[model samples]
Target: MAKRRLIKALAALLAVLAVIGIARAGGLYLNHTASYPRGLWQKSGDYDPTHAGEHPYVLACAPGKSVRREFIERGYLPWGFDCDGVEALLKRIWAVAGDRWTVTDAGIEVNGQLVPNTQPLTEDSAGRSMPVQTGGIVPVGHVLLLSDYHPRSFDGRYFGTTPIKDLISEVTPLWTESP
Candidate 1:
């Protein structure tokens, strides 16, 4: 009888742990990157409602193995933020489907206007050559994630376009402070 009770207890414990993991994964998102305003955001399970030129933010992970490998090798991801396998990158959408985007030595341009402070740095803070800016067309089912708030942000300027299917959630500002 005691052994049966112990087995039941273990099963109950496992079920509780599973629920906890799910809740934590679905809980509030904290904007730890300078790419967006610093604060706590509510993560909603919804498709991106952002339009072109709006620059709305979302929670995303590396869309492919190559991007994940680069992020790991180059230290592009912030320390200790691995979500499952790929680290989460919270960023504003510079361009949506059908919007044209470009990255050059001059700066990043979307729809023919250069965004200020987007000029590619020749070197990084660690004195290494900056990763090449891979400009991309905002393809259907993809978004270009970038940031105007941070000049040296590791973003679309570095990673190029991201698949929209990789978005973890749409973040809405719950509490924030000016950058």
Candidate 2:
């Protein structure tokens, strides 16, 4: 009887361990998808929902942190990119190249010249692209990003441009070779 009870207890313990492992793996996958910086979760910073009366260049997905590796592998751009990856990429570009870009209601202006809105870039998802504009000059440290599909996205068209300083990190593929 004692041996049987011990075996049963050990089996229960193993089952619990397995459950814990699966949960941890799921969490890690979600973080990867949410585009959190590589390795270990850390607070990026407080991003004010309001652009603070300044023109923004980047659009960040709300609930930005997760661990979904499949989403990243699919080249989904940013996790919450409802349109194209325009908002996320613009934020990254602005962070790298400052003072050279501007956001406005007439579209993106580079070096005081207007950049006509490009054709809607398509992701795997199906959607139509829309144009966005603002009436303010993109400050020296900002870039304006909008979703390629404005009607379905909550991006620069809604929140304005993002500051270059608020960018957390860029997401790139971990592997290139096909499985």
Candidate 3:
């Protein structure tokens, strides 16, 4: 009977620990939810853990209307805004201000060098055709967000460039993992 009681106690302890962990993961504090430092789960291959060490993260504040529309269509509210959408995004700087950027339906080139695996698609998942914006001088106060790792990443290839006004902060990953 003592052994059974000890086992039951251990199971109960484990259950409590599990609940705490789940609450923490879900941003819940006891019965309430914590609000600071909102967490975002990344499901796409645009950015990878391997590149985090090599690149300094740039948290851009500017999210254009097209990107906002795309996020809404995809059912992602990211920053908790109902219509305006996420005000900032953590993206690696693929092309910076004053760099010669050329974009075409075939691929993208930065400073005359073809960015690997950055081919623009003719159509998206919804069968809507994608537009091609020819390469041009990356204007002052604008940045391009693209990843060589993700062949099909939705980035500058589809949305063009991000203005500096939309940038909010440059952030380092506090905790990240791949599923």
All candidates' lDDT scores?
0.74, 0.39, 0.58
Instruction: Arrange candidates by lDDT, descending.
Output: 1, 3, 2
Clashing pairs in 3: 60-167, 61-166, 61-167, 61-168, 62-166, 62-167, 102-135, 103-135
lDDT of 2 by residue, 35-144 (tens): 22223232223334244323233324422223123334444444443323322332322212233445555554555655444222333343433333342655655445
What does the lDDT come to for candidate 1? Answer: 0.74
Model 3 TM-score, 2 decimals: 0.57
True-structure RMSD, every candidate: 6.3, 11.6, 10.4
lDDT (C-alpha) at residue 129 in model 3: 76
Angstrom error at residue 21, model 3: 16
Worst 10 residues of 2 by lDDT: 28-37
Per-prediction TM-score, please?
A: 0.75, 0.31, 0.57
Clashes of each: 0, 20, 8
Q: What is the descending TM-score order?
A: 1, 3, 2
Segments of candidate 1 deviating more than 4 angstroms = 1-26, 79-83, 134-136
